[model samples]
Target: MISAALTVEQRQRLVRVARGQEDGDLLIRGASVVQPATREVFEADVVIAEGRIAAFGPGYGAARVVGARGAFLAPGFMDGHVHIESSLLTPAGFARAVLPRGTTGIVAEPHELVNVVGAAGLGWMLDAGRSSGLRVWASAPSCVPASEFEQGGAAVGAADIAEMLALPSVLGLAEMMNYPGVLNADPGVWEVLEAGRRAGGFGAARRMDGHASGVGGRDLHAYAAAGLHSDHEATTPEEARERLRAGLWLMVREGSAARNLAALLPVLREGPRRAMLVSDDVSVDELLELGHLDRLLRMCVSGGLHPADAVALVTCNPAEYWGLHDYGLLAPGYHADCVLLKDLAGFEVLETFVGGQEARAGSSTPPLPGGGVDLGAGWSAATFDVPAHWPVMEVRPDQITTGMGAPGSGDTRLVVADRYGRAGPGQTAHSTCWTSGTGLTGGTLGISVLHDAHNAAFLGGTDADIRAAGAALEQLGGGVVVVAGGEVRASLPLPYAGLMTDADPHAAAAAVGQITAAVRALGCVLPYPVTTLSFLGLTVIPALKLTPRGLLDVGAWQMIGGADHN
Candidate 1:
């Protein structure tokens, strides 16, 4: 049958090929093709022409035929949600790493970069992703500054949303982390949503992603009712089920900070058609060690999920939710993207083909892959001050929270500063708090991954250590640095927006590994020290958090006395 997807010129050629009047471009012979939609498998010869499946049968002929040797041929995988910048590699380098793992498409959110450089930063990301020869579609950043309590480099408004949503490469609005705005009927929230709708009219689906973490009851309903269609923050099965019942697609994620696959995998048993898989955030080390979406797929399948169901979550389900009709399938007229797997149990990819060309998985180098991240001048400068009388932010090896402490209490100090020049030159917002019992008796750790905000966060047992650490980080452009006894102990330079490195994934991972070890030696027991410290700046998460503006009492949804030096 001639695929309706064929163009006028391609259709004529497809007709001739089916009639045996022309030879197809390529053919994979002797493979068990898994049709994810129908959950069926059939041994067949799949033929390709003009980068589309032209014919599929045992007798099909083609100019190039590769014997599959009974491998399992499945549709190329898709990452429903991801932040490519977290990998610390440029989009092209990131593609080189993950393409071998069978990821053909990605739905990315460049909010991290947007937080650092605003919309202009997103433009560079879009161009790099497109030039990589991978399908990299982004969602308009729904919360550029995230919220009022935090200070970011840029404040993206309704105008920004409308402009970004209209881009051909943009899928829709990204996860709106401001659930309070939706429930409270905030004008700013509505303005952004309305703008998204108007601009998304050019596409088939007007999608607004959600970030309602830890919210439940009627608030969940109201938030979903506000036109949000999908969520990746459902950490528990109860939350997943509730969101699913409320008509929100649940994206079960397993990333660097949190792993929700085990908690939410049960929802899949209920035949949750709306469920998808995502890695909202992942570190360079994690990507190189495990993989992208392929890692998540292995977990699902190994945990006893039906192979077809597991595959559907990454392929058909995400494609449908994102309205990407041309991808996520191995059918007629679809792009000739396929993954030849060694087996379903491990989902080990033998080869990945995109547009009928085999993707190459090449080696990478250190310091930079493709190109080095640009670090501006005056990076080594550090200007900060802490009041003598202020509440201390106590840090346990397990958690970080605020406490009341007196001078000479041996409490460690935590400080956050705006690094993006967002608040004018030399006018960066700064906040400091004291803390005890973190066990870091004599060193400082400074990093740029002030989560959600991508600011600069410094933690130290002594004032001098912190000062030295900050200077060291600035010298490296933007990265994590550990200092003790007035000397630099270890560091990792992430020159990309002070958040990510342009180094090779493996090399970046190694650098981060060294920093992790150094921070651990400085008395941090958290499994992911860099990630845990980065989250300190994320005010949206519960319990307690610190922003460049000041300390935030998340439960109360208000700023505390980190700014008020009483």
Candidate 2:
């Protein structure tokens, strides 16, 4: 039923060979096969005729066959959860970057791209992905603009979810970011959740996954009972264990920024409840260097987890949890998707076979046709604006915090201001920028690209550093910058919409690494960086954050003004 993809003669021949009436189409003669479904290990012959596995065991015959003499055959990996936009690479370009590492399928959430360009942007990615070799599935964005605190390119209502649900590739709603609305039964929230549920329940029925980052215990139970099943926000082992006990399918994630995987490997061997692996917000550079889901497999092994189980995390576990029918195995009648690994420790991919064809051309990656879509157009190749005086605006005398925003005193009451409609669902919150920009005294300064809210708000002794950095951002369109002493100190041009660079992903990664040296040259106390990016706009992550708007109190869901309590 997969259309005229394969010729009739090919199908007949596949059927004949699978039934053993004739010789097989192609054969992987003598290689050790790891079957994740049955947890079986054996040396066998794997044969494929028409896009699906035709036969297995001692012998096979076909017109053309691959010789995988010293390799491990694994089902092409599936990244259970992801946000393709974070990479700053278009779908076509992202695929080109990851395929060589043996990732064949990805469950991507386009909420960020949707925010930047709306449904047309999502539609752009879906159409482009379909024609490519890799298979990409979508999850109807549950939170279009994410939250009210920031501005985006567009907003999607329930009607949009319903429309997206109709697509064959849509995989239910993305992580429901609005827990407050769900708790209060807000109509807008329910409208989108219900539409996605309808689509998920179509045909064989799918599930609406949850994104409750900080919600736990009774609240977690409330969310699970409300029909949201899976979550990737379980950052700690205790958090993940609780979700697992509550029957929520857990997706252990390890993207470029967030790395909560090391603490969760013990759960992999605890039982067979639904546990999946995800690359939630990977960039092209990380995907190119460390790989995708396969990266998790290697990490698991290094962390003392079973290699086969690690592979299972990417294959059978996710397919079963997400209800993907045509993928995740290499048995008779199953789609012919397999990855050949040279070893199990690092689990290096020697070759990847998809639908009876070798996905790679020789040892090198195949060239993308017409190359691929360029994402550099999202914003100009410039930096942002900086003021003359980096407002050290204060409400009290004792609050001079250097890094991220946090209230200095623990007792002063904050003025409940909702001047702008930037508060989340039922919460009243205050925002920065517009007011802080008003009263500015000129001087020299410094800045960091605060990962949580995109650009790092300027922290300065004088306004000149901030002004120069802002000028550089406007000139480069978007990227991280630091201005010091009224001149550009150091800058990294994120030409891909102020988020990523168009340079080779490897070079981009190396460029990002250069910051360590630059920061060492400056002597600061910012501990770690990539992890910092993960906490951006993440009201779910515990503790505090510095947003482009201001410092936010995640638990209270509001921005704490100067002199507010910690």
Candidate 3:
């Protein structure tokens, strides 16, 4: 997409085209333009000149014109918040998958990559986004390690944040997962928040995002008071209402494992002024099988939301929140980023235009560098040994949050190994525990896609199977793997930062499907088993979680028991 800002020459040309003094570069005729701001739809002709909307009416001259066939021409959809890494695809690969589905812009947070490879990872993503044919704005990752309780490959301090904030593409601070630190006025957290605030000294003030899962009342107020502008972790109408009332934008998230859009629809219906739809973490399979923002629009309209209102949520609403004044509208002088939809109810995108140019899948840019995994050489089957008395983390079906299980109970064994070699000389690099509700009876599932840290994690019925899975991951560099009876069953390699791949979307989705099916064959029942397993290592979420240090009691903000290792 071309830059939103117009040059002097471009602005002059647009004015001439609007007044019919000069021919426009392109003209879209017979389109039912959907006005998101006015909540109305009307038939008109759209004139595009110098990558900006020149006018809207009939009898305009242009170099080229295409018939819309009475299709709905709406402002292209924009994702309010997303982690590009969660798609298990590089920024380039991610853009290819979503651009054809009607998402022309996104506010991406590279925390997942930062957690695994630090500031360099963020740079790599920014460079990749430049040529992805998508308008990618970044929010500097606020919590690289997510919290002090977990160990990540690298740490991003206040200085690092200040440096990132100076970049033009970086809009604000990413999700503040360390809510406890913010509430207690932790010096480090305050310093980082202050850095974001200071960036606006020379320009518009930067914004901050929140990740307060299950936080409420005075705590939520305090979080908002610290200049946090939005939250995407609300899973219920009540939660959504509280965040909205607290003066924070509500990003109603619907992703592979956590489907909260259906439950939060009431809040959006009540008042969509501060609400926008976001895909917080979509997998390749979900992106290919269902769709992107288009899928959310279909669901919202089907659930009784007015078609215009639903379109506004992904268009005008997000554009306003992000201070993108020149986007999310079809009026003259706005950037001509639009989607040609077959109908409002279905929202089937026939063509997507970014800055008046047709967008196509795949990138022309070279792939970014990979190779972030760094497990030490002493790994073996003996690394899986753990006492039966260790606490077990219980996986909640279709949710990222976990629960506590009886010690030594359940058929599945869990292990979190530090892939960055961050463990000290004497401290064990791996932690062992048990888990229930995964439904795995006879195989091992190994993943390097663990949330926040991207560590190597394994779950299995036996130590030998776990060893087999680990070996396969080590050989593939980093990715997902399934093993049983000491043989590799299935795998998918994520070569970029051990969290994403540069493969085409279809190939990546097919690989994910094979891995999901393999896990199901071994008796696992979760709809997205690989995604569910990836979250087991997240230390910020509620109830129970596992980290390389040990099993974490999230509420208590400490390890549940003494470190369990071989």
Best by TM-score: 3
lDDT of each: 0.75, 0.60, 0.85
lDDT string, candidate 3, 502-538, tens digits:
8898999999999889989999988898888889989
Give candidate 1's error at residue 460 in angstroms. Answer: 3.6
Indicate the residue-level lDDT of 50 in model 2: 70
- Residue 512, candidate 2: Cα error in Å is 2.6
Task: For candidate 1, report its TM-score.
Answer: 0.89
A best-first ranking of the candidates according to their TM-score comes to 3, 1, 2
Off by over 4 Å in 1: 1-7, 18-20, 202-205, 361-413, 422-428, 434-442, 564-566
- How high a TM-score does candidate 2 get? 0.79
Please list the residue runs of candidate 2 whose C-alpha ends up more than 4 Å from where it truly belongs after superposition.
1-11, 22-25, 201-205, 360-462, 482-503, 524-531, 546-550, 562-566
Candidate 1, residue 359: Cα displacement in angstroms equals 1.4
Error of 3 at 210 (Å): 0.8
Give a tens-digit lDDT track for model 2, residues 1-566: 11135578877777888877786667887777888777766788888877888878775677776777857888888887887657655555566677778888888787755654456555655765665567777887778755544434367889987887777677777888878778778899888877876775544335787888778989999888878889988777789999988999999888766677887777766754589888887755567767887788888889876777778889988888777776798787677878888988888888876676776321222222211111122122222332222232222111111222222322111111111223344433322221121122322122222222233234322323444544565566555554455555556675433444445556655655554344444443233233233244344344343443454455666655431111
Query: Candidate 3 has which clashing residue pairs, if any?
Result: none
